[model samples]
Target chain A: MSDELYDDLILDHYESPYHRGRLESASCEHTELNPLCGDRVQLQLQIDEERRIQQAYFEGEGCAISQAAASILCEHIEGRTLGEVEAFDARQMLDLLQVRLTATRQRCGLLGFKVLKTLAYAYDGTAGTSA
Target chain B: MENIRSDFPILGRPLADGTPLVYLDSGSSAQKPQVVIDALVECYQTYYANAHRGVYQFGVQIDEALEGARERIAAMLGAAEVEEVVFTSGTTMSINLVAQAWARMVLEEGDEVLVNEMEHHANLVPWQQVVRQTGAVLKHIPLTDDGHLDLDQLQNCLGPRTKLIAVTGMSNVLGTINPIGRLVEAAATVGARVLVDGAQSVPHAAINVQDPAIDFLAFSGHKLYGPSGIGVLYGRRELLEMMDPFLCGGNMISEVGLTESTWADLPAKFEAGTLPVAEAIALGTAVDYVTDIGFEQIGRIERALLVEAQTRLQEIPDLVIHGPDVDHKGAIISFTDPRVHPHDMAELLKRKGVALRAGHHCAMPLHARLGVVATTRVSLAVYNTSADIDVLIEAIHYARKVLRRD
Candidate 1:
């Protein structure tokens, strides 16, 4: 159990992930695939009239890090503004992970974050635009 | 096997974390024996020169060494002539040579090229490229439930209009040893030439290029304990003569002019530009090293290891092995554990200093067919021992505990 990759926190979140389902009538959604290892993370967000992320959920398949990242990111942005979600960067995502990952596996940790950043970066979708 | 282990220096090296190394990725690339390593050094130190172009001392000696290696390798493959062996970068290049040079030349608009799902992409994609280029229909032999190629479907797939059949001697992912001899016999009845991708099977079993009388065979050196960047494409001489060169330059032309050029003879015609000099020589040494150990002893030891691994792995209630029974399989084992995904398990196992192959193992189509995104592969070679398997089982259990609720 010396491997930091499977610490109790990551495994717990992976086992009972938060908001791990389709977000029906989501404002916007984006999916990122790590073709190298077949990891796919789909992040969906619902925006209110105030432009805040009213709801967030994720659907993913693959490594624990990618899936766990999806849960962590979705929960982190549940009530945050679209601007704050767009402002989230790779370093902050790793800071949220609070674990060490080698350069090769950093992609796994960042897959879900990429989806969130991509969707919020555009931010032009209308009501129920996510398909 | 004791003697075999000593021949590979890396087998004794410990991992950086001070865990005793248990390498199980030889299906992707086998470890090099000291003999092969020495041959690589010897090529430059004693016999280094531009091949087929110079007439000086080192040139002649290098030429002799290179051709001598070819003769021995040809004999090992049961090839009728040494010139039938054309060295390329690796298995992918070999298949490309046949597809671009041979298939493109022969295939008519409606000709059928038969393949199966079990083939590695190296064997499958090249045929796909050629068929699209020549309007040949690419058909597949559906796999059985247990992952063997459906030979009964072979009857429906092959006909007089079928120009070629591309098959793998062994499945890289499922460890299924295909019935190449029977397949070749059936292909002959329909007048379809057969190309066997020997990237996995050549290292594990005894095969005859002549007895089955296969039209082409392709394999890589690194997978057979030789250096990387070198592969062989053994084609029938008459067929090689009918096709044009895949790559053209100084080393592969009979005569070249500003406007016109004539190609060189059989093997050299396909091999363009300067070859991988040191790697080519070392591949010969690898062939010799395995020859000295003998396929009989290799097979016996590998069979025992496979049986032991399969038996041990099956004991884990959550683990599911993907392949045929041990009787029809090779030493390779690919499996998925529902409790722990392959990537997580592989990472945790690496912490314990046991190496394995994860991801699709360059066989994504096979993974798609099996309905698995990825798997963990433990591929054994002569140097691997039962102790390695013990470490593997222990590490796997350790990995599961780390990733699973239990």
Candidate 2:
């Protein structure tokens, strides 16, 4: 089915969503919610040796912004380390997503970025996992 | 009635992509008519003056305008007197006024407040807070499978200790037209004062406060094709005289000294400092416009819309209607496609130039009782037509394909 409702960026993320699962024996976990719209997401991260992000996956149910944001985030940060991910913020993700989000939806779309930042805080100056 | 749609300016405007915007969220807020706009503009341009305390020419003129607006609203509701009408900031504030003024004065530790499960949070929360403050138990009357209030259960709920009953004239979610007369009768047996939430009902049909013998009736101006931030709370003159004022200010108080104070009379006592004078006058004009177009005509059109929507929605196999399937139901229609979440459905509809509400719709208790988490709601008004329902049907099919991945 063709969804003319969504722009190309959203359609791309919907069809081939990234970070759509959970990382096994993950190194970090965080949850985010959009109370107004009832959108929620729980993200789990796994870091391998050499301080590289081995995998990042999230499991949750929400509107287009959240699903597309998660997919786009995973696609971008799969190979990057915590340092690279921490450097980015809501503005960078909003620029990448390139969609018109209301004030509340911006928060929903940026929740993953916030969770990743918190995980980066916990993983600060830490040694990589044995995996 | 024939030219009713043309009176709305928004209906003539196009969306960003030049698609005609089909508005179906009248339950959230009704579109303003030309008469309402003119009334608002007239107040700002010509009759811009403070009311009540102005002994001068402009003050007296504004005072007359405000009192005339109250009388018009009273006539619309079949209220016994104009003094029974107290203007405030929409239905939420009106309800809170009753909860704060009357409930605070009367309710005691052992008393109970009876509320229908179908009430909006505005009505429910005030009573909840009141009960918490007074140590009074808050009891709920369950809704039937068809979304109608269970009168039998209501009877059981209204015991000797029951002091108040707050019931919705119409369920905003289910479109169920509850029998307010019967609820009022039952509550009367327990000597309980009833406040009818007419926010959803008065917009779709004519309401008579006196005929129902309801102690209080509350409705918003915006929902009835008027301006926002304005609403009317109609209480029996005796009841209004009995209750204390909720807010204190210049207009509400009669005499104030450093040590002692006295309050104003009737409507003025309830209205605080500065009032929404323009909105109140515009509301009166809206009532005139609605009366001229005829509520019976509006009801006939709404029935047609409901029938068309029900037929189209029922065509989808997984679609389930949430309320009583009767002609008497209001124009509001809420339903859910089994495989699709309501939020996705609403987004898809928006892309098709359709505007509708999605989610629990602020009636969490009723939705929870109905055994569904959430549903998409397409509410109708006089401005809506059958063609809008057709587009909504096509949009729902499109939503099913997208969300269900069929």
Candidate 3:
């Protein structure tokens, strides 16, 4: 469990996170913090006229599990519709990470997914932000 | 003293994956010794009964044991009277008792409650809430760059309205022991009372409440290698008598009429309902156990381990140890590395069967003062040896390799 949890893929993603910045022209942005570990994730989405995600970016601080999970989530959410992201489940996020997490680490693995889903729900394409 | 680890049964066990368990989070709570465990089992298995109220033989025996435990704790603290030692649930409850019963009664709207920025939330939050309720102002004495209290500012912080000064005897995060004697003297000159939070100090150091400067002290038994759910609040007898009861119930009241009630005397006035009898008795045994080992010997062994740990940890590149140098610190070491997040480091270390604490360590304000959101802390106990420190160093290297990309 330990070796698989810190596999090479996770380590690579954590070291060089993809889309690791805020989108100034984001239609809606949402930030969430795991108070227990002080893990933070700020996810921004630039939705187009068709309500598809034109761009997705994030920036935050946390453990490897959380940072890598956010980076993996950014790659999956970009170019997807807001409705598609809202339908994403915790199991799919766990499957994306390709690691077995204990109950405590599961929160870290899903922090990005939770934040994106929250933005999807609250986003009315009004160009606003909530933390 | 040579084979103290043998006395602690948990230290002999292994983790689920068969890794030798290296328990290092003693500042949170020390692993219990077999004698303390046996004392708890003896209470329930043989003579479990309600204490202080029972008339039967079992009750009488339990009552006598409770008083005996009180006497042992009083002697440990060097209290003039056993009544000064009031058993509470833990340190948080003890401080809450003082805040509610003492501060609420004496403090006016303009009075000041002085605390330091380095205090654990257990000591800080209670005073915050108390001052809010009493309309008194809550102020803090800032910390120096090395994490020691800024005592030079104490004279300015103390004034006529300074009614109480609450300070931690030793910081849980930095392990810096404050000069309680100096703080007490400063408070005395201004005619203000002092309450020393000994949750971190009393377990690792020897304290004598017989000093005229100290007015109140609170500590938890779990940190002293005893069972949880038991703590001691040593107050000056006069203050304990004058303050109103924090909790009122069966044992804490002398008489109750339709519209009036009279509280019980001394310790009972604060202790309400049934006490944690088994835990208290085990705590007494723990006090005796530590006394038998003697703080002088404990301090020597722990200081050696701490110096060795500091020397090895300092060798790690990019790792920053917080607080004063080893000479002024206790058995706790808190550090941060830029390459590895504290949570990640702690989780990886746990897999290697090296248990440590990470996060703000309940000292968020102090962490903020240090300019870091969190840190990984390895706090030592009597059962821990230099061998355990070696394991920790090796684990840190493994963590760096696994976590750092460059």
Which parts of model 2 have CA positions greater than 4 angstroms off? A1-30, A45-57, A71-84, A95-104, A118-131, B371-373, B401-406
True lDDT of residue B274, candidate 2? 92
Tens-digit per-residue lDDT, B1-406, candidate 1? 7778888999898877677888999998999999999999988888799788789999888888888888878988999999999998999999999999899999999999999988898999899999999999999999987999988888988888898999999899899998888888988898889999999999988777999899999999999999999989999999998999889887889999999999999789988899997888889988898888888888999999999998999998879999899999999999999878888888888987888988998888889899999999999998888998999999899888777745
Cα lDDT of model 3 by residue, B22-121, tens digit: 9999999999988999999999999989888889988998988889999999998999999999999989999999999999999999899999899999
lDDT minimum window of 10 residues, candidate 1 chain B: B397-406
Give me the runs in candidate 1 sitting further than 4 Å from their true place. A1-3, A128-131
* Fraction of native contacts, model 3: 0.55
Q: Which structure is stronger by TM-score: 1 or 2?
A: 1
Native contacts retained, all candidates in order:
0.68, 0.32, 0.55
TM-score of each model's chain B: 0.98, 0.97, 0.99
**Residue-wise lDDT of candidate 3 within A1-131, one digit each (tens)?**
23667887798899888999978888888888888888898888888978899988999988899999999999988889978887888999999999899999999999998999888887776666563
Candidate achieving the largest lDDT: 3
Error of 1 at B366 (Å): 1.2
Give per-residue CA lDDT, model 2, range B62-94, as digits (tens). Answer: 888878888889998999888899999989999
Poorest 10 consecutive residues by lDDT, candidate 3 chain B? B397-406
